[model samples]
Target: MNFNEVISNARDSLTVKRVYGDPYEKDGLTVIPAASVRGGAGGGSGHDEKGQEGGGGGFGVNARPAGAYVIKDGDVSWRPALDVNRLIAATGLAVIVYLISRPRMARARAKSSESPSES
Candidate 1:
């Protein structure tokens, strides 16, 4: 192509458009029309805006109850049911064992205390 044709083509592809706004304003704070608002998660903190240390609201979508169902390994599952009877039995056995050992432990402690210290 001729030099003039090449220059003209480059100029045609390089048209400039003006953006009307305060360049320093936060993103969503600009007074654009409602219809012009593009849908998506936008209009909060600007790219350069320094957000608060930790002042966001609302629990996240993943927040749930302690025993809530969760998916694992492509399968749905929930916390196991508690066995009240087994828990009670285990607790009772622990108490019995402690009571039975208390006297023996006390006797051993007394014997140790009565023993003379070696030089």
Candidate 2:
């Protein structure tokens, strides 16, 4: 499967819950799988009206609401989003490329080393 599919599958396997944001306020929090954060699958945009027109050849009022998602505390406590497995895979690929190119680099070094030095 592709990267997206892998992330989607991981998201599907997680648990979620809905809880109150603050005991005093009526706002609610929907706690989603932590994996959802990595996949961009949890939050979405909201509507606003302040962004409409441009003034005198200037840029228009570009306003957009930020997406929100709830993260709970645990071994899965929310941190900055990243895919650890993907990072490892990328590092491995880089190592492989470096290994594959090593022979050419070595050949060039040998050629340079073997050249007679100018007196």
Q: What is the Cα-based lDDT of residue 107 in candidate 2?
A: 96
Across 12-105, the per-residue lDDT of candidate 2 in tens digits comes to 5432422212222124434433223222233223345886543221111222222234543322233344557778999999999999999999
In the predicted model 2, the residue pairs found to clash are none
lDDT tens per residue, model 1, 38-99: 11111122233565432222111121112323344445554443557778999999999999
**TM-scores, each model vs. reference:** 0.34, 0.34
CA lDDT of each prediction against the hidden true structure: 0.43, 0.46
- Highest TM-score scorer: 1
The superposed Cα distance between candidate 2 and the true structure at residue 42, in angstroms, equals: 22
lDDT, model 1, position 19: 17
